[model samples]
Target: MLKIEGLNVYSDNKKILENINLEFEYGKLYLIFGASGSGKTTLAKAILNDESLKKEGKIFLDNIDITNEKTENTSNIYFILFRILLK
Candidate 1:
């Protein structure tokens, strides 16, 4: 299982994501969607342990704390970014 607790992300002292919590069980697929600039990418980056953003929270994978782990260490998590444009 993957879990996030009280996830907060900030950029240049401005809050990008606030108090986010989530859980993903094994063998399940989930999708996150929102309007542009709604922090979807920020959330993904937080999960991937992006050092550029100031983050506060805890990330767990299978009951293991991975919040401070390097991105390369969390190879099991995959994030895909794409946009659908309508004509």
Candidate 2:
């Protein structure tokens, strides 16, 4: 399961996300839909822990919070973005 609570993302003093909360459970799926500049890409990057992207949030994977830490290789922003764009 995945849980995101009070997720906030900012870049260069501009807020991109605010108070984002979500839960992802096994066998359940979700999608993020928005127009351009709606912070969709920014959220994706935050989730992946991109070095160039700064954000504040609580991310729980299987109930483990991995916030403001260097994520593993599984956290690849480009892959996720490309997969979403191709869909």
Candidate 3:
């Protein structure tokens, strides 16, 4: 399970997300939808811990906080993502 609570992301000190909350569970089909410039990509990058996408919130997986974890900690998410896309 993944949970994001009260997320507030910023870029160059400009707020991009506010009071964002979300939850994802295993074996579930998830879709991210939003209009252009609605912070869709930003949210993805934040979840993947992309260096360019700074984050200002707590990210949890299975009740463990992963916010600031190293890139290696995100390998599982990326692996599944690449496999699905490559298929």
Give the candidate number with the greatest TM-score: 1
Cα displacement (Å) at residue 69, model 3: 1.1
C-alpha RMSD in Å of predicted model 2 compared with the true structure = 4.4
TM-score of 1: 0.84
Which residue pairs come into collision in candidate 2?
none
lDDT of 2 by residue, 11-87 (tens): 88788899899886655457889999998988877877767766776977667776665756437533563455455
lDDT tens digits, residue span 56-77, model 3: 8798877888877777768685
Which residue pairs come into collision in candidate 3? none
Candidates ranked by TM-score: 1, 3, 2
In candidate 1, which residue ranges exceed 4 Å CA deviation? 76-87
Please give the RMSD to the true structure for each candidate, in Å.
Answer: 6.1, 4.4, 3.1
Error of 2 at 5 (Å): 0.5
Off by over 4 Å in 2: 74-87
Q: If both were scored by lDDT, which would come out higher, candidate 1 or candidate 3?
A: 1
| Top lDDT model | 1
How would you encode candidate 1's per-residue C-alpha lDDT over 30-75 as one tens digit per residue?
7889999999999988888888888898989778898988887764
TM-score of each: 0.84, 0.76, 0.79
Measured on C-alpha atoms, candidate 1 has an lDDT of 0.80
**Best of the two (1, 2) by TM-score:** 1
- Flag the better candidate by TM-score, 1 or 3: 1
